[model samples]
Target chain A: MTSHPPAGTPSGIVLEHVTKRFGRTEVLTDISAVLPPGRIYGLLGANGVGKTTLMSLVCNHTFRSGGTVLIDGEDPAENPVVLGRTCFIREDQPYNDAFKVRDVLSAVSWFYPDWDAALAERLADRFHLPHRTTCKKLSRGQRSALAIVISLASRAAYTFLDEPYLGLDPSARGIFYDELLLAYSEHPRTIVMSTHLIDEAAGLLEEVLVLHEGRIVLRADADEARTSAFVARGLDSAVTALVGHREVLSERRLGSILSVTVRGARTADDESRARAANIALEAASLQELVAAIGIGGIGGVDTESFTTQRTSR
Target chain B: MTYARRSLRLYLANRSYVTLIPGGILVIMLAMSLVIGVAIGMATEFPLSAQIQEGMRENNGGAVYSIPGFLISLGALAVNRNFAMALAFGSTRRHFWLGTLMGFGLTSGATAASAVVLLALEKATNHWFFGVYAFDVAALGKGDYVLTFASVFVLAVLSLALGALFGTAYRAFGTKGALLTGLAAAVLVVAVTLLSASNKEIVGSWLGALGVWAAVVVAAIAAAISIAGSYAANRLARL
Candidate 1:
C-alpha cells in the first residue's frame, strides 16, 4: 500500500553540514551524520542541546536554515514519497483537541500505508488508554501512551521518537520497551529515539549520537561508547598525579575524594598505578559520557580549564 | 491512499463537524424562519396567502448565512488544529494544501447543492405552500436556482479561505500575530468600504455594469489569493 517503493539501495539519513537557526540563535550547527537503515540509533543530549531540533530537521518537520538533509538519498521537504516513509512524533505532539483517543488512532492509520490497526488496539488495551476520551482530557501518561501507539504502529521506514517516555511509569515504560523491541524485530525499521533516561534506553540503542551545543560531539557504537571514556575515583592529589595532564571530560568532588571521568580507555600501566594509589578505574556508562560531554565541553572546547575550575571548587 | 487523499481523510475525520453540524444548523435556521413567517402571516390583517406572499417579497431570510459562517469557523479550526498533526504524521506541505483545497471544494459544493435543492423545493411548493420564503430570500438569488447555487458556493469558498488565512497567521506567528492580521483585514475592509462610499457614483456605475458574475469572479480571486497566502504561512510555521 506504500505510495512509493522502498529504496533499492537505501543510504538511510545522510545529513551534511546541516544547520538550524531560530532568529539570531543557531540551534544546530554543522551537524553531519549518516544514519544507515535498519538500526536503532540513540540521539543522546542534554536539554536544549539540539537533539529534538536535529530530529525535526531530518524529518523536514521544520525547514533547515542551511545544509543538505537527505533521507534515502532524497530531499524530504514537501516530497510525499519521502515523507510517506518517515514519521517524527514530538514530545508534546499536538492532537486535535476535539479528537478522541480512538479518533486520533483512526485518523493516523489512514496516513501510514503499513499502519497496524490490530497492534494499535492491543497497545491501547495494554496501556489502559480510554478509547473514548478526548485527547485534551487525557492525562500526560495517557498522552504518552497514545504517542507510543502511533509511533510503533506506523511501521514507517524511518521513525523519530523525541522523548517518547515523558510521563510513563516504570511498568508502562517496560511495556513500551517490550512492544518497541517486538515491533522492531518483526518489521526492522530505522528508529532514532532521543531520551534523557540514557541508561534505561541504553540497551535498545545500537549506535549513539551525543549532541553538545548544537554539535555532535560524540558518535560511536553503543558498546564502543561505553568504553570511550573511563571514570577514576580516588583522592584529588593521587588521581591528578597519576592522570598526568590527560583529557578530563568531567570531575566531581565530595569533600576530599575526587571522581573524574577522563577520555580514552584506561591503559594497563594506568590501571596498575590506579590500583597502587587506591584509585578505582571503571568504564564510563553512556549516561555519564553524555553528561560529561555536555558539562565539560567537547568538540575542541577548553575542557582543561573547565576541569581545573570544577576540581578547585 | 495518495498523500492528498490521506490529508482529505484527515480533514474529514470528524464527520460531525464537517457535514452534520452545518446541515443541522441550516435545518434549524429554516425551521425558525418558517415559524417567524407563520407568526407574521397570522398577525396580518390581509388574507393569509396575500399577506404571506407580500411578507416574503418584502423580507429576505438571514438563515442561510449560518452555513457559510459555520464553514468559516471549521476552516480556521482545521488549520489551527490539524496542520501540525498532519506534518508529524508525514504529510508533505503540498499534499496538505491539495487535500485541504479538495476538502473545501467538497464542503462548499455540497452545501451549495443543498441550498439549490431547498430553493427548488421552496419554489415548487410556492414558498412552503404559503410563501414562507425560507430559501426564496432575495439574497439567495430570489429563487433563481443557478444564481443561488453559484452565490452560495462562492461565499462558502470565500469564508473557508478567509478562515484558513487567519489560522495560518496564527500558526506562522503567535496570538498577537493572528490578532494583528485580523485587525489589518478589518481595517482593509473598512477602508475599501469607505473609499467605495466616497466614490459611490463611479464605483456604483462600475459595479452595476459588471453585474453578478463580476462579484463572483472577485470573490473567487480573493479566495485564490487567500489560499496562496495560507500556503506561504504554512511554510513559515514551525512545529
Candidate 2:
C-alpha cells in the first residue's frame, strides 16, 4: 500500500500510520504519506486541519502519538544527526531579546554543518531587515521575511515552511516566492510548504497533497490531479449518464442545468465521451479540486494535511 | 568577519531583548539602591569587613552570600513571561542566560572595583573605609563566623544554579509556569527567612555551615534534574 523511493537518494520523509493526539482530541489519525527528495510539494488544506501537526511530526518538533518518521532513513526524534539536516521554521519563531539580528545568524551558523552563510547574507539583503531593528520592533511583514530568509538560506535538505507568508504583503510575498524558487533550482531539496493561498502559489508546486478530515483525498502531480478530475457542464440527465459508476467530487444545480465535477481521465476516451454527449469538458485546477473535496463533505471540518513519505527521485 | 556579521545580525534582529527599556522606574530604582547602599555605609562609619561579618552573623554559621534571592525569581519570570521577545532574532534560552550572567558579573565587578577604589581614597583621606553590614556577635566566638562565610558562598552557588534551572523551566512552560514557579520560590523564601535565626544557630553552633551547604547541595541536585528534564521535554514537543 506504500510507494517506494527512487534509486540514488535518501527518502527525505517517511510517515507510516502516524497519529497525534492533543489530550482527548485526535489531531492526526493514522496518517501515512511519503515525500521524496528534490521536489517542491504543496501541502494544502483548510483551517484546523492537521497540516501543521503532520509537518511538526516529520520534523521531530513534536512527539508522534503513533507511527514512525524516517528522515534520510533515520529517526528524527531527538536525534541531532537527523535534526541538523532539517529546518522547521515555525509560524511564530522566538528569539532571545538580548540578541541582535547579526548575533542570531552567528549562533544558527554553528547548528548546521552545511549552512550557507553567503546565501544567508544575500537573502538578508533581499529581505531588507534593518540591521539594528530588534526583533520586537519589526513589523509583521518583516518577521515573516526573517523566517523566509532563514528557511531558504539554511539550505537544510529537508525544509518545512509552515505558513511562511502569513503577514507578508503581495510584493514581499512575490520576493519570497522568487527567492524560494531560485534557491530550489540552485540546490534542489524536499520542500513541503503548507499554505492557504493555493492559486497564488499554484505554479511553484510540482505536486499537490490535498487533505480532508485527517485523510489524504488527493495526491498526484499538479497537472495529473487536475487532469484526473474534469468538470462536465451539460443538462442534468446527460451529466448523470456521463458520471455513471464514476466518482462525483461535487455537483451544482441551477434551474434544471448542472455542473458536475466527475473523477475521470484526462485521456482521449474521457474527452471523447464528454464531446460525444455534447457536454463542455474542462480540466480542474488545484484550487477547484481542493474546494470541491473540502466543501463536498468528502472530508469533515477537521481535515488533515497531505503528509508525504520521501522517495529518492 | 564571520563573527562580526553574526553579532551584527543578532543585535539588529534581537528586538525582544529591548524590554530592558531604559525606563524611569528601573533607572530610579537602580540609582536609588546604589545611592542608599553607598550613603548608609558612609554615614555609619562601619567597616566593610564588619558588614560582611554581620551577614555572617545573620546566617549564624550560614554563608555570607549577597545574591538577592529575588533576582532568581525575576530571571525565571523574565525569560518565560516574554517568550515571544525571547524567540526573536537574538534571544534563545541558552544565550539569554549566558548574556544575563555576563551582565550580572560585570555589574558586580564594577561594584567591587568601586568599593576598592573608595577604600583606597578613604585611606588617602585619613578615614576608615565604612561598611554597610557589620558582623556583630553577642555570644558567637571571635576570629570569624566560620559557618557564616561558608553559608554565604554555598547559598550564592545554590541560588545561581537554581536560577538557571528554574529560568529554563519557566521559559518552556510559559506564563503560567513562570508564575507558579515564582510563587513557589517566594513562599520558600519566606519560609527560609522565618527559620533563619534558629537554623543558623544550630548549623553555626556545632555543625557549622556544613549543614546549610548540605541543604544547598540537595537543592542544586534537584535543579540539575529539573533543567535536564525540561530540555528533553522541549526537544520532544517543540515544533
Candidate 3:
C-alpha cells in the first residue's frame, strides 16, 4: 500500500581461489569471483559444474579443500553467528517424514532467532500444504515449497537457494518468483540462486555469475551483460563490412540473413553504418550470453571486427 | 530445542524403515518357541518323563540357547535401524541409542512377560527338575521364590542388555556392522556353551545362579551407560 523504501544496499560477496574436493574427485577448482550483494544473483552453470559445491563452501555446509570465501567479511565455517545469519535450503533437506508440516515449522522456528512464524504459515497456505499431512506424504513440489517457506521466513541475512525449482512447473515457478520478489522488496537480504532454466528465470535475476567447469566464466550486471553483446543480422557481405576485427562469440546463418553474437559494445559509427546497411541488431539476452560464454567463453572464440552491433528491438 | 527432545521427535517421525519387520520377527520367534516345544513333545512320543529329560539337556539346552539368541537378534541392527530416524530430527548419536533401546525395551517387556507367565504356569504342574518342588518356589518362606523370580528378572534384564549392547555398537555400522554382530554372537554362544559344559552344575546354589544373573545384569547396565556417554561426548565434538 505505502511506497516501498529502497532495498538495503549490501555490498558484494568475495570468493578467493576457493577450491573444494570430495576425497580424490575435485568438485571445484580455483573458483574466484566478486559478487555484489543487495541485487538478486543468478549462479548459472550446468549440473555438476561446481555451482552447488561453491555455494556449499560459501554457506559452510561442507569444508573446502583449499582457498577462502568471505561473506561480506569474515569466514563462515563453524561461526554460529555467521551460520545463524545464513539460510541455505538444501535440495533434499533432511527431515523426518513422520513429522507433520507444523512440527517442522515449529522446530525450524527455534533454529533461527529471527524466524517469522507468521510468514512461514502464510507461505505454507500459499503453497497449499496441509498442516496435517506429514512431510513423507507431501509431494516433491510441496517439499520444495516448504523449503522456500523456511528460507524466506528465517529472514537470514544471507540466503542461498540451490536450484530451488527443479521439479516445479512454470506456473508454480511463477508463484515462487512472485513471492520471492515480494519478500525481497520487503526485506532485502542477499540471495544467491543457482538454476538450470536460465532463459525462464532471466527476468528475475539482477546480476549473473556464469561458471564453466568450476571457474567463473563471466560476472556482471544482467542487463549490462546482455547489452555488452549483440547479434547483428544483414547480408553476410554487408554485415562483414561493418564488423572488422572484434571477438566473435558465435555466428549462425539463417538463409541470407547473417546473425552473429559479437563481444564489445556498439559504437556510434558502428550503429550508423548498420542503419546505412539496413541491418538489424538484437541485444543478447542473459541466456544467450551465458550460452555463448558457456560454450567457449575465453578460449576458441573467433575474432572479427564487430561495428554493426546495435539493438534493433 | 534440546538435542534429546529433537532426537525423540525425529525418532517418532522416521518412516524410511518399518518397525513392523522386527516386530513380525518377534511374533515368529514366539511361535517358533511354541512349535519347538511341540516338536519336543511329539518326537519324544509325548511321554512326560522323556520330555522332561530332553528339556534339561536336548541340543545343549535348547531353552537356554533361545534366551541369548532372541536377545541378540532383537537388540541388534533390527533395533539399531530405528535410530536412523533420529538423524532427521538432528539427533545426536547418544540420544539415538537411548531412544532405540527404549523402543525395543517396550516390545521386549511385553514378549518376556507373556513367556514368563506361560513358563510359570507350566512349572506349576510339570515338575521337570528333580527335587525342585514347585510348591517350594511358591512357599516364599526360604526365599527360593525370590531367588527364582529374581533369576527371571536377571535373565530378562541381561537379555535386553545384550540386545542394547549390539544395537549401540551397531548403530553407526551400517550393513557390514550387522555381519560383524552375527559373528560376534556366534562366538559368544560357543564360549558360553563350552564354559557351561566344562562346569556341569553351573547353578551351584539357587542364590549363586541369581548372583551370576545379577552380575551380568549390572555389567550390561554399566556398559550401556559407558557407550551412550561416550557417544554424547563424541557427537558434541563432530563427525
Best by DockQ: 1
Segments of candidate 3 deviating more than 4 angstroms: A1-14, A22-25, A34-39, A70-74, A78-81, A92-107, A130-140, A299-313, B1-8, B12-239
After superposing candidate 2 on the true structure, give the runs of residues whose Cα lies further than 4 Å from its correct spot: A1-9, A97-103, A234-237, A253-257, A266-278, A299-313, B1-239
Q: What do the candidate models score in CA lDDT, each in turn?
A: 0.83, 0.60, 0.61
- Which is the winner by DockQ between candidate 1 and candidate 2? 1
On residues B1-239, what C-alpha lDDT tens digit does candidate 3 reach at each position? 24344433333443322233333443454456445555665665443355454433333222233455655555553334334333322233444555554544444444444444434544664633231222222211122444434443344445555655555544435446546755865786688668767775753453376653544454455445534533443233211
Q: How close is candidate 2 to the true structure, as a TM-score?
A: 0.71
Give the winner by lDDT: 1 or 3.
Answer: 1
In candidate 1 chain B, what residue range of length 10 has the lowest lDDT sum? B45-54
TM-score head-to-head 1 vs 3, winner: 1
DockQ of 3: 0.09
Model 2, residue B219: displacement in angstroms? Answer: 6.6
- C-alpha positional error of residue B89 in candidate 1 after TM-score superposition, expressed in Å: 1.1
- TM-score for chain B in model 2: 0.39
What's the number of clashes in each of the models? 0, 57, 7
lDDT of 1 by residue, A1-313 (tens): 1122255357688887789999999999887778889999999989999988898888788889999888887888888888888888898889999899999999999899899999999999999999999999999899889989999999999989989898899999999999999999999999999999999999999998888888887788899889878999999899988777777888999988999998778999998899899999999999999999778765453211222222322
Best by TM-score: 1
iRMS (Å) per candidate: 0.8, 6.8, 6.2
Question: Candidate 1 vs candidate 2: which has greater lDDT?
Answer: 1
